[model samples]
Target: MTSDLKNRLAQEAQDIGFDACRICRPWDVPLVPDRLEAFVAKKRHGQMGWMAERMNWRGNPAALWPDARSVIMLGESYTPEHDPMEVLKHPGRGGISVYAQNKDYHDLVKKRLKRLARWLIADSGGEVKVFVDTAPVPEKPLGEAAGLGWQGKHTNLVSREMGNWFFLGSVFTTIELPVDTAEVDHCGSCRSCLDACPTDAFPAPYQLDARRCISYLTIEHKGPIDEELRALMGNRIYGCDDCLAACPWNKFAVEARELRYAARDELKAPKLAELATLDDTAFRAFFSGSPIKRIGRDRFVRNVLYAIGNSDRAELRIVAQGLVDDADETVRDAARWAAGRLTE
Candidate 1:
């Protein structure tokens, strides 16, 4: 009966546009706490203070809800129709991460997860809770534990079938669904992801220093970015996908099923000059349903200015000059930095 129910749940997930689904027991990742502690001890998480706060629940899923017997892991593919790295060559344009180029996955994935969890509750007569990157759940470890994929050297899940271009969602349940075997690390001897990093964010194989990571700087960071790292940022105004894009396993990746995830033309390669003109009101309207909206206009413009500094296009310097005395100190700092670089 458990096996039958699991099969039905998987089918329902695929029918609802999820690329893949697998199950695992909540206590599968025994080493999560130690690994998490080591990461925190090294100050590798950077400004993401929330990672340090949710110690018990983030490291141990079983502690989150003792009644939850199994975790249903789901994968949603958003493989880009074009090469994500191509924009870096065009310095005048800002390169937003492939994931943020479309509608926010948090909203899209959460809606699908809730529907799947609701179906499971009705079929197996048990309670369920769904999560889509919002909670402190160790999603990559849980994804590996559920036989979905192993965490690659870059610290993101990679699947032979799904590749690295996917988002993970979880459904914790009271029903004891049959669990799948965990995936073993298949990264073998590839360091393409490490070499691909523009900022060399990986201090060692299988580890990341979030402080040096461009994704962290543009999104999670609040104030001025270090001058040394600013030039390395290079046209990337949002999250970086270098490591994910460099994975060899992506050769086997399948296209995303959801049309909502397809890239919008305006966001694909926005001109840095145009983005610099986005005041708060315009920024809100432009990024209405996008994940980039969460960072707000000040932070977003701060990133655009950083890219403008790195672009080497003297013409764009005037655009940066306009914001030199902006109200937000962070934006003003970035504008000043850009002006200096362009003038030099």
Candidate 2:
């Protein structure tokens, strides 16, 4: 009876637009606490103090909700139709991560999770809690524990069916369901992801030092980025996708079902100079539904300045020079740095 319910749940999830769904017990990921502790101990999480603050809940999904018996891990594909790396060649443009190029995945994925959770409760008479990226739930680890995919060498989940270009969401329930077998590592002898990092963020295979990661630098970081790392950032003004795009498993990536995940024409190769002119109001309006809006104008322009500094295009110096006296100290700093680099 439980097997039939699980099978039906998977079909329901797929019908609701999730590419994959698998189940595991909330206590399945026993190794997370140790790994998370070690990462925080080394200060590798950088300014994401919340990772340390919510250590216990994040490390133990069972502790997150004691009543939860099974975790339904779901993968939603957002694979890009074009070469994500192609924009890097055009130094005049700012490269936005494929995931952030359109509607926020959090909003889209959470809605799907909620719909599935509601179905589970109706069919099985169990309470359910749904989570997207915002939660402390270790979705990747639980995804692996549930056989959705193995965590690749770059530390992101990679699937034989969907590749590494999918988002993860989870449904935790009080009703116990049969668990799927955990996936084993299939990244043996592959260092593609590690070598692909422009900032050398990976300290070793499977270990990421967020302090040097471009995605962390351009997004979560609040102040001016380090001088050395800024140069390596290239034209990437938002989150970086170097490592994910480098993975060989992406060849089998499933096509994204949601039209909103597709990159907008303007974002695909946005002119860095045009981006730097966005004031607060313009920034908000331009990125109203984009995940990039959360970073605000100052940080967004700061990243643009870093890209301007790296562009080696003399014409962009005027764009950088205009912001050197801006109100935000960090923006002023980035502007001065970009102008100075262009001058040299």
Candidate 3:
């Protein structure tokens, strides 16, 4: 029976290292199009113009594949062993997001999704497709719809069981399966996530302005950051976790079971001075197999210099000054800003 098969699929997902699994119909996420339209209308996605490019597919999963009847949403936790917020106090060290401190989750999660998808097809004889964070699927909304978690005020999915520290992956299939009940918001009157944003990226409750987010500035953004927001970035050189760290629900989070997600010893609290000294070759080698590699040398260095400017360590001025005459204009601009701040 379909019910027994769903149970097997859930068991397989757990055995494959996913912390949670839930199912829902493709049409469950009906609100995505309008929500996405409003987010894009305000030009809030910053330089990630790709958000505006895939409206049809992202807005409605049913439209992506007309015959697909169910969406299997899986959650994999990567909760850190240490307090992620602790690094912000040490301006001398760079704070990469816990998510980026290990191997790229996209590759790891996608491979797992494909494995589960293959099992579903072999068990049920249905065509299937898999997606991690890279695709145009409205994953957060679909996640909420699948009863895997609810979209918290910070706009990331939060589960009563898994908290806010999980990545979502989806498997779409033509086999119709029983769906799980959607989760409800449990963030009653808690402004912890909103107040935690260093850049005040949230314009209102349950909304975000990606333009001002440190994560966007350091990662997706290709050029120099606005000087106003750069100062707020502090030592966070990659993705910012202020909101996720502030979520009180994370107390119940399960630690990641996958060894691939464990933080590398060298990345725990990298020295900003050491990071600023990386040339293109060194940057690539240092970040190989890590998600930070995608940002490349120039952008990564630009972020490092921004942290250097925010760092009150006067000795770090020389590190910034050395890069002031570098080939990349953006890196030079960031270095000049950092040198000026340190000397001031």
TM-score of each: 0.99, 0.99, 0.99
Best by lDDT: 2
- Scored by CA lDDT, what does every candidate get? 0.94, 0.95, 0.92
Expressed as tens digits, the lDDT of each residue in 1-344 for candidate 2 is: 99999999999999999999999999999999999999999999999999999999999999999999999999999999989999999999999999999999999999999999889878879899989988798999999999999988889999999999999999999999999999999998999999999999998998999999999999999998999999999999999999999999999999999999999999999999999999999999999899999999999999999999999999999999999899999999999999999999
| Model 1 lDDT per residue over 186-266, tens place | 998899999999999998998999999999999999999999999999999999999999999999899998888899999
Model 1 scores worst on lDDT over the 10 consecutive residues at 117-126
Native-vs-model 2 lDDT?
0.95
TM-score of 3: 0.99
Per-residue lDDT over 101-205 for candidate 3, one digit per residue giving the tens place of the 0 to 100 score: 989999999999999998987898989999997778999999999898888889999999988999999999999999999998899999999998999999998
Using lDDT, rank the candidates from best to worst: 2, 1, 3
Shift in Å, residue 276, candidate 3: 0.8
